[model samples]
Target: MAEPFHIGFLLFPNLTQLDFTGPLQVLARLPGAKLHLVAKTKGPVETDCGPFLLADTDFNDCPKLDMLCVPGGFGIDQAMQDADTIAFVKRQAEGARYVTSVCTGAFILGAAGLLKGKRATTHWAWHSHLARVGAEPVKARVVRDGNLFTGGGVTAGIDFALTITAEIAGESVARAIQLGIEYDPAPPFDSGAPDRAQPETLEICERRYAGRVADFEAALAAALG
Candidate 1:
């Protein structure tokens, strides 16, 4: 029998639930996979939008993971400056087969010093921020540099997990999982990307996220220095 794959996903306050849950759904189906929802402590963690998820284990209790996954959201702004959280990620990533993140989670990985010189991607708004941590930011839904895998924005976690699934299991297994999930995505609109969105729509989003961008940049500067 194949060895059980121990996979840990970092959970924290204000995370975008989809970033974690989307990947969790795919990875949980992997053959011989054990999933761990880890946090600084074992308890309920709230999302930016008010959903609560219970953490399965505290960092101290988690076994060395085969893969360490981080999912990002507004809370990531604070996580980047958190020594304990960053230390946990660094410690797990040191021995993990894959160090991965979704969306702004890349910033947390950067703060851990894991992204140095690696090709990575994050939310479109934070593409320029990757350079602050010495990472080469690639514009794509998913970017893989060796064992470091990063997914862009909120909805990209599904794609990222399938990519990891294919790498660890096989394309056949990945395809089967994708089929099970009915992963065919047909969006109602073509405004998912900045380039495809109308000028007014982009402007509104940019304006709404400007403060968040500033906050993240400040946190990254502190974490990197």
Candidate 2:
């Protein structure tokens, strides 16, 4: 029998729900996978979209995981500066076979000094911030530098999880899972990315993230120092 594979997602207040749940829907199907939603405490973690997710284990009680995934949102503006969160992530990465993040969660890993000198990526608006933490940011949905993996933005986590599934279990297993989930993305609009978006669409996106980008940069600066 295959050994049990423990997968963990770091839960925090104000995370983008899609970043955590999108990947959850896919990675949960990995054969022999046991999922752990971990946080500073076994309490309610809120999402940016006004929903709440419960973390099953606190950092102290969580089992050693085979994989650890951090999900991003505006909450990351605060999470990146949290010492306990950074320490827990740093500690978990030391033993996990795969260390990964979705969207701006990469900055939390950056806070732990995990991304130093690594090729990584994050949400397009914040891609430049990667270099502040010593990461060479790439412009792609999924990027892997050794054992570290990063997803571009919220919805990109689904693709990121599938890629990791292919790496660990193989193409066949990943394909089966993708098929089972009917993971076909056919959005009615072609504005998912910055380059493809109409100028007005890009403007709205920029406006939405304008304040957040500023706050996150300040947090990132404080966290790194």
Candidate 3:
């Protein structure tokens, strides 16, 4: 009998719910996929939005995954600095057919030493920091280098998942999923990217990230040490 295609998303406290759910919604439809929401424990994990996601499998019980995704959120500041979490990601990457992350989740992959010497990307706000983890940062919705894949920002996780799905199953399958989910994207604003955002909008975003960036840098330093 063919082994089920195991797919996992690493869950941690305070992850942006969309980062995890957006991708899961797409990947869950993959042919014969067996999905797992893995975390440190079976207890519920609190997302940044105040909602909680229950883990079906703990790190210790997770089966070897064919594909693994780590989603980003403020929780990354904590997860990147976590030794057990880093070790778990590292160990899983050794056997995963594809190792991937979304947004700042790239930092966790980097902390696991998975992004070193790889070309990758993350949320634009944190794109430059990819270099700190020894990665050549690329700006794109999805960047794939060898078996490592990464998505940009939060909503990009869905795009990233579709890309991987196409690779694994086929373009036809991916197209069907996209149509099924109506993955058409038409945002009300053209200011999603820094290049497109107005000067004032960019300034506001910068101000908002000022403190968060500092905290992220400190966590990155400690994790990479």
Best by lDDT: 3
* TM-score of model number 2: 0.98
Task: Return the TM-score for each candidate structure.
Answer: 0.98, 0.98, 0.98
Evaluate model 1: give its lDDT: 0.94
Scored by lDDT, model 3 comes in at 0.95
Which residues of candidate 1, in runs, are more than 4 Å off?
none
Q: What is the C-alpha lDDT of each candidate?
A: 0.94, 0.94, 0.95
Higher-ranked by lDDT: 2 or 3: 3
Q: Candidate 3: TM-score?
A: 0.98
Q: Can you write out model 1's per-residue Cα lDDT over 1-225, one digit (the tens) per residue?
A: 777899999999999999999999999999999999999999999998897999999989999999999999999878888899989998999899999999999999999989999999999988888988889989999999999999999999999999999999999999999999999999999999999999999999999999999887777788777
Worst 10 residues of 1 by lDDT: 216-225
Candidate 2 collision pairs: none
**lDDT digits (tens) for residues 170-205 of candidate 2:** 999999999999999999999999999999999998
